[model samples]
Target: MKLSFYLHKNGAKYAMLTSIGGCISILGYLIYILNPLQLILDKLLTFQPGSLIFKLWTQPPYEVLAKIYIFNVTNSEQFLAGKEKLNLTQTGPYVYQEIVHNSEAIFNENGTLTYKPIRELKFRPELSVEDPDKARIIGPNIPLLGISSYMKNEYGLFMNLGFSSVVNMVKSPSLTNLSVTEYLFGYEDPLVELASTYVPSWIDFTKFGILDRLMSIDNGNTITMHLSTNTTSKDDILYQYSVDIFNGSPGLKQWGYREDIPEENSPCNTVEGAFESGVFPRHLKENTTVRLYRKAFCRSTSMIYENTDYTSSGMKYYNYRIDQNFLSTSEENPENKCFCKNSKKCLPKGFGSLDPCYYGIPIAMSQPHYLNADPEIRKQVIGMNPDQEKHDTVMKLSPELGIPIYARLRMQINLNVSPDQIVTSSKPFQGMILPLFWVELGIYDMPSYLGILINIAAQIPTIEMVTSYILGMIGALMIATVGVCVIRGFNQNRSDVESENQGLESSPFLSIPVQPIIRSEFKLLR
Candidate 1:
């Protein structure tokens, strides 16, 4: 009885242990299936005000540099005299630090946030090749060239005659020598003042600075972005926080898209649902295409996956290059037909007209040194050397986090000069696409704190998965051990029962018959 009691007690103990083991196994599986860590990460990555990602996005704590190289005219006099082709020499990499942040933030109930972008540029002399104030470049007179080009397109013969007379009276040269700072920032020119005075409606500003106007912070433009609060799908997460609207509109009015035009019909003018280079979609694949919008570019540019790369710290990144056909004419790419604007024929396969956005100036944009441009466009100039390594626009993005680690955005600004027989001052620059300057805006290195966060974020999934797998294995072993113990206990109990049965059958007392034992006892009593 004691042995039976002991076995029963042990069986109850084993049953309790088996239940615990089963529970542990179930708990491990639940952990693996639920992936609570990833859910926490998603919450942290949301664009709420107090979230870590929102703080980083609001005020980026990294250095962004703008390296500018001006094409200085070497032989202005000889070129104007028709004695030689326009000779140009690449001058410098005038480095400037760009400070950017979002201001006047307004959170909306529709899962969107609106804010005005504030950008400021400060010159970094230590990083530049030379002082922009001292370096002089003989380049085309931007004001004169732009005004002349506009007049030729919009005005009649009588207006052109009057413009020519005024040009001759001011003795405006086709080219002027000015310091790099004046060319980039602002330069006092009599023609600019004259144009402002005469055509105040068209030429509202008396100053014309390429960089100053391009990087103007007080434009009163606000951007609205979608916040990812709805779904946890990988693609949806990647598409999170993309641009939704600009200046209260999703399509650019300057690009001639009607307000009612569907997004599918007008892809170029539609600025909605693009990344502003501050962030990208997560889990980028080889076939993933990214669209980036910049106020300076005046439109969204597409980037395609090129290859894989690694950061200095060995973090993996996907390399994306600007689409080769971004600036192609309609003949080459039918989708670009909208970029023609008011022109009957599109600008060559290389150039995209920026006149619509640049206050009616005939400014065109191309790859630096006319890379991937028509061969004839390069043949018209003397010193243009297109090198892909130095001029291509590329962005290196972290696949897991969808963040841009390193980026190089290169673009060349040129004057689309059309020779005017009516305006004699423009005769020297007839039919010339004059290269002005090129800029490479980039972020070379990430801040240490940001890097640490990225590292942690990148490893979280792997760590969580590994820990879950280990727990599952441990739980499986525990359940298996409990099963083995229960089987052994059952076998031992059966053996004990069989031994007891056998002993009862073999005992001398039990072997005697019950009736005979009773009869013997009665005779003894008598």
Candidate 2:
């Protein structure tokens, strides 16, 4: 009885231990399979109110520097006399800190948000090569040139003659020496005042500042973006927080695309699916192409993958550059034909017309020093030295988060001078695309705190993997312990049975005895 009781008690104990081990193993496996780490990460990366990413998007922590380099005309006399090609000398890198803020953000129910961007520029003298107010540049008369170019196309002969008379009365020089500050911010010119007075509809502002007009923010302009938080699908997550609309429209009316036009017909004017320079999508791949939209540019520009690289802190980044065919003529890149504004004649292979967006001013944009421009266009200028290192537009982005680690966005502003026989001052600049200035705007490096956050975000996958492995190991160990318990229980039960049988065989009273006189006893009974 005692032996039987001991065997039952030990068997029950083993069974209880096996149940506990099985439960622990199952718990460990469930933890690993559920992947709670990923859930936490997704929540952190989502762009919503009170989220880290949203805060960063609203106000970036790093500084964006604008370095302006103006091109000074050195041989204006000789060039005007038709004796020399337009000779230019590159001038100072007047630095400014550009502060951006997304104001009055409103979150919508359809997984989108809208906000107005307010940007301010502050001069950083310490970072500049020289004082802009004191630095002088002998450059083309922008007011005279821009007006002459506009009138040549829009005004009749009588209007052109009147404009020519006004120009002669004001004695506007074909080229003028002015402080860099005046050239960039604003300058007092009688021609500009007269134009504003006469044609307020076209030239409302009496002062014309290239950078000032470019950076001016319209209060009514707002940007709507996809939050990318509604779905957990990988593909959907790849395009997180991309632009959805600009100024309440996906395509610009200025670029000949109205609300009625299909997006496929006017792809160049489509602003949707592009990202602002401050933020990009997550999980960027090598083959992925990115488009950046800026109000100043009036269109989105494409950036293609160039190579893979590492930041100074050992974080991985993917390098991208402005598409080489971004400004190419239709002959070179047919897709850019829409930029010609329905005209069969497009600008030369290098220039992009900005007149549609720049108040009828015949301003064109190109890469700094006309890098990769047509040989003919470069031949027209004497001082153009297109160095890839200094002139090319480049952006280094984190592959995982699509964050811009370092970027240099370079662009040169040029005036398209179409000479008018009626306007004699413009005849000197006949058939010329004059480079006025170029700007390099970007951040040099990420702040240390931002780098730390990026590193942590990058390590999330590894952390999740390690955690899963640990949980799996724990589960395996618990399962193995359960197996050991089962084996030991079976062996103990068998040994107990054997010992009980031996006891029965060795017992005095409980044993069975064999009879020797069985045959004789059987016969007597019969």
Candidate 3:
């Protein structure tokens, strides 16, 4: 009975260990299958044909203005239009609503996808600064187009106008007569539109031919953007609209990831691919440089660098830059008739110099905060903090998810002025790149699915760690208990043997038994 009990006890312990180990094995397998990377890939690849993720990602989200800062510079030593202008800075809030008129998407035979895009724009004149009209016209002269408001209106641009007028203007405003109505309200010339004139005509949203130009490059609407569907190398996808004007091929890969993130063969340009692959060569902490395509200025390559990294809402990101010096040179983009036609000088890095088509009036572009730009850029422009924290065109993203978390696409519109017969007023100005205003498109609060994805990524590792630790501790405790029980059983058996030997040695019968047995044996023999 005792042996049976011992066997049972040992057997029970062995069974318990086996059961615990089995549970751990099952859990580990589950965790691996549900790993964050696999989960994200599953969702993206297995999307039912018209799912929300499909629509949102393929269409992308719209952005709104969070704030606006105008930079005005003055020379105590010089004057324009015979005015000793006071250098000043103006800041305020702006609002607008984007309207998507039509959109469509289709899967392609090349394992790619295409989308057709149609959108419209509207601005809220109310809930804005007063002198809404004068405030609208700030910037350097675009000749027949306009100038920065600071240069246009010597007085102040802020009127702190009430909301009623703005509401009425937008409530029944005629789309056909936008220019006239806005002009009458002193809101006709938006600073962004002024900035757009300086951008290459192909990428200029303000131009009516934007759609045609985009389609002409590849014979597909801007909405028909080609996207890679292969998930193996999430980093290898390139999504920017191609600039195929010179190549005469299907849209040339002009924008988006130009080279591999780590110089690997994997894709790295598509927004989706980057998220899936976590391969942002530009995101390297080592300050690596990358080349990307730009659709606006005749499909050109931009040399940029990962300057730093940041985090928000549990997501990680890297900051990259297209500073003036880096942008001023690119063999990929030859000087074209539309821009750089005159001096054939590469446009200054930050400023857009597509003045050839705009009546020889040079329009320049820069960042809102002018981060990483020429020192002279901020020096001439007041009200600019020039802090990288505020002004950089930052692309905040998650390294793990390879998706953009938040983005601040910022740029300033400036006009280059010089003494010439075309404009006698600019003669006294010398050669100066005068800033008109800067705007930022702040896109944040990622779609719900993306947030879910990030959370899962964060949670999976935690679950694995916690579960492993707890299971490990339990397993260690069980092993220790079994070992102690085994040691105690061995000690108990040894003690039992010793006690039995002592009892046998202390028996009184055994002391006298030897002599008695000898006498009895002799009598029996007789």
Per-residue CA lDDT of candidate 3, range 389-420, in tens?
Answer: 66666555454444456656566656565322
Say what the RMSD of model 2 is. Answer: 5.1
Cα error, residue 53 of model 3, in Å, equals: 4.9
Please report the TM-score between candidate 3 and the true structure: 0.60
RMSD of 3: 10.8
lDDT of candidate 3 vs native? Answer: 0.44
lDDT (10s digit) by residue, model 1, range 284-376: 677688888887777788989888877666677888999999998888888787888676447898898888888777888999999999889
Of 1 and 3, the candidate ahead on TM-score is: 1
Question: Per-residue CA lDDT of candidate 2, range 1-526, in tens?
Answer: 5445555766667566656656656655665677566677568767789997788878887789999999988888888888988899998799999888888999998878899888888999998999898888899999889888888877788888888999999999898888888889888888889878988987778887778778863334788988764465556654567787888887777777777748445568787777873677777778678888887776779999988887666678888999999989877888787788743347898898888888877888999999988878888788899999999989888876668988899989999887544677778887888899999998875678778867776776677667666755665675577577666767777888899899988998755454646876898999
**Model 3 ranges with Cα > 4 A deviation:** 9-17, 29-91, 97-102, 117-315, 329-350, 355-362, 368-390, 416-419, 422-434, 444-452, 472-505, 516-526
Flag clash pairs in model 1.
Answer: none
Displacement of the residue 417 alpha carbon in candidate 3, Å: 5.6
Best by TM-score: 1
Best by lDDT: 1
Candidate 2 segments whose C-alpha is farther than 4 A from its true place: 1-28, 217-220, 229-240, 308-314, 342-344, 478-526
